[model samples]
Target: MRIIIKGGIWKNTEDEILKAAVSKYGKNQWARISSLLVRKSPKQCKARWYEWLDPSIKKTEWSKEEDEKLLHLAKLMPTQWRTIAPIVGRTPSQCLERYQKLLDEAEAKEGADLDLTGPTGGDAGPSADDVRRLRPGEIDPDPETKPARPDPVDMDEDEKEMLSEARARLANTQGKKAKRKAREKQLEEARRLASLQKRRELKAAGIELKGKKKKKGMDYNADIPFEKKPALGFYDTTEEKNRQIEPGFTNVHLHKLEGKRRSEINEEKRKKKQKTDSEGGVGFVPARASQLNKLKQAEQISKRRKLLLPAPQVGENELEEIVKIGFAGENTKAVVGETDNVSSLSDYTPSSTGLPLRTPRLIGGSLQTPRTPLSVRSLRTPTTERARLNRRSQVVKRDLPRPVHVDELTIDDLTYEGSEIEKIIDLEMIKLLKHDAIVYPVHGSKLNSQNLESIESFEEFTDELMNQAREAINAEIKITANESDLPEDWPKFEDLTGIKQCQNQLEINRNLMIKDASRAAKLEKKLNITLGGYLVCYKVSRSSALVKKTLESFEEVEQAKIELDSFQSLNLSEKVAIPKRIETLQNEVDHLVRREHELQERYATLLNQKQEIQLRIEDLFAKTNGNA
Candidate 1:
């Protein structure tokens, strides 16, 4: 047989030629086989043998046992299909294809398992056994019998309805199962492709693929040193050594003596006390009688020293005469000479000529010498008078006074006539009184209706009568005054009467108003005092209430503290049980977390299935359009 290859065309003769060549040369000798087949390349011959001519190629579904064997060989020799082919009883290409299918299925199953173990998936799906158990019974009783064709007769309505329902339910369950399988297959393919891409990326980055190594168990004896076996004994001895030291060392030397020595010390202290008592209790010291008498005499002398001494006698007339002539120039020399004589003389003595001596003593004491008769000059002017005259002589002199003139008065004297006195009357007094008055009149009559109506009390009525009297007096005075004699600013009789009445009314009103104001002010002050007392009382009450409330709150707090203490004094079992409860709750929380993970996975699967269905629908639409 002969074959031709031009523009990828193949004929029945080509297949025959390839088969015949393969049969003669075997599957491996692609070059020899190609030489026998004319117009065919060795590569082409090899591809044809593996793809079509080889009887070992698995066109049927791979069984479980075959799949397991393939997986085992693939794991032992990854990507080495030629080496694994004979062991699996398949061609290299067939082995490779089966291994790849197994890998895709494994990846899909892993992806589905991963989705099932997620944070929010529902409970696990039914297993194969559960699915089988849940499968409905067969409708037909006979194993080999098919349902016969429906008779031409009409069926019972109930039977028809039941059949239809059964069909619908069966259809629904089958559709759901098919959809689940399709979704699982799609997920497997997607995860497989993703895993492949990840491996490719890792390979490109020069990272070596390796499995996680298992950790070895801990060796407890590794860290212990044989030489240090007695180190733990050191801690035990340390505690004993610490205990041997006296705990009462701090108070051991507090007392100076102890036991029999303490009694001896007490006896010595008693002896000391007895000796002190025998010696006047340690603080008594007796003074001599003579020393006491001397101290008394010294106190008496000091008291006598403070008594007033009699002043020297001098005649008032003599002292006055000295003061009068003290400032005279002629007496100045005499006064100075006397002062010198007084400074030089130490004591008064009788002179040889029978003159009395002036006694000299300290200014603070009396003279101790016997009395001598006074000299004529000394009797006339005493020592005090002489001293006064001398002191006056040392004073500075005053200038002469200026002369006074009686005719040079600055104020003028007044002369009064009987007629002028009569005219003056009380006009000045009235004007002064008017100026000092607190109330002034408005330009209106006091007898007006408004004024009358404004009088609200008896006081106001009396005020009106007084105003009328004052107005009459003012009108009489104005009427008696001549126009030429009247002041320029003075009003006429009628106007003056009206003004006086208004002033009187205003004054009365002012006094009445002032009395009311004073009363109101007194009332306001009383009210303020009452309010202040009330505020003080309120503050005191509030403070007391606050103190009471605070104490009550404190009591409550103390009670709560006591309760807390009682609660804290619980049994060891109860305390231990609390942690157990916590652990159980933690376990429950872990279980809930797993449940939530399952729910999330189920939701994700549903979402993925929805998306796949949408994609399939889109593909179907595309295919329909393409067919059209």
Candidate 2:
């Protein structure tokens, strides 16, 4: 078997395909983008984009300032092209290449000067471009950072297949969603025709079936699906419903009597509706279920109702008795000097003559609370749904299709009675069909919350039914997968690559966070020092509302004391007297702290690595022992 490697200088076809893939799937989906180009990996696709093909890359000739800044930054942060690239407004590869080119020019200049003084060779060595150029049969090491070569007139079969596959994938704008919608539409049309045919057949046989117009399909209690209307003219006709044409033709015939599709009938009806609507909006059209909701709304708005208050509580007799009690209390208080308790003047009932309790004021028809004597309205939403679920479940159980044997059952042994065996076979077939319905859902049916909850908690099934379902699912998957044309292991590879990239990013971010934390501490210290003098000076000069500022300054002072103490062990007198020496000492102290932090970080990393290796060794030993 011949071994084939999958990367080299990118061709024109591959480059174009890559560009199209990126536009479709985007830069983040490098695995998907690279799948179009058989020769490139995800990393290569990403590098190609960032290093050369990206629109954001500055491909123009390098300016003098850029060169100077590049050299300055390069000297300051050596071998950190990745860090310097963003600051230089370029990619890492571009920065490195430019830096090397400048160095080569300087070296050549020095060599020219040397050649002037001493004897030189007759032939000049290869130029920088030629020196780096790949020989025939030798792969280009950094092909991603180079421009794509021109494409040949004829493409290889594999390349053609890949192109076609990519084209097909991209062209399918709707994908699974479109396929689902199409299936739903077909199912709906089939259901409508089936219903119409049934009704026609019944009428033809002289059996006038009178079924109520339902708002929902199968789940009759659910809310009707309505098309939302745009805000419109006065009197609000937004509640108008779409009308359907119930075909009146008795039979299929020639000329105008020829059978028309449901869509055609609807289109004809719509044209008539438009004509009626154009005639100054005078007509009221009814839905198939019943009258238009707009008519009901208009009627409700037009009507006037009597103010019917809650059935009059505290009738004439009760009111009269209450007034008499109040008068008696006042008269008794005025006549008698005062009771033992002066506050008792308000109470006419001397514990014995307390008025009899009357029934609570009649409110809306709801059950009253026992202790509080108040009517609490029930929450109908969940209760109504629960009721519907119970109703539906009962109906489904009661009205399940009576088992009529379609296939004849014959047993050579005749171990069990024929009726008993037939009944069992029917039950198993019913269960199988139920399983199929759950697994392969119908497009026409809509499930409410009750159905969804019920689905989640299913009844027990026989092992035979489960096995049959499993086999069916597997068969379906196999048949569909043949047309998908994807490598089976590619998805696993993508997952691995994603996890690796994420881990790499986490490490980079961790380092950045550590660096930022240290820098922030330094900045915070400097900030407090800079602002500390202002607060002190202001408080000394001013009197009004200076406490707030003084407290702030005090807090800053305390922080500064802590920071300074932590900074150095030397006392004020022992510290360096000279300004430059003080500065140098601070710099040295900072350098040592930074070095310590870096060392600690490295130690932690090495510790983690050690643990990982130890675990791996244990795993290996366990596996070896198991094998033995």
For lDDT, the strongest prediction is: 2
lDDT of 2 by residue, 139-173 (tens): 77888888888777687888799889888877764
Worst 10 residues of 2 by lDDT: 401-410
lDDT of 1 by residue, 1-628 (tens): 6344411333344565556655544578877655544445777666666655567665655666788898887888888987887787766766765676666667659868888433434665554334434246534222111112333246556435644553443344335577899999999999989977897899899986764656487546765434555544434466666666657665666354344576888999999987876677334334444566889999999887666879969889978876665546345555666755643333233456853477677577987566555523442247655644433211111222211211221222112234655545444333222222212222331233332322331121243565697799899988796777566645565577667666756876899899999999999999998798787799789999999999999999999999888778776568889999999999999998899789779989998999999999999989998999
TM-score of each: 0.17, 0.28
CA lDDT, candidate 1, residue 134: 27
Superposed Cα deviation of residue 150, candidate 2 (Å): 0.8
TM-score of 1: 0.17
Best-fitting candidate, scored by TM-score: 2
Where does model 2 exceed 4 Å of error? 1-3, 114-121, 125-130, 173-628
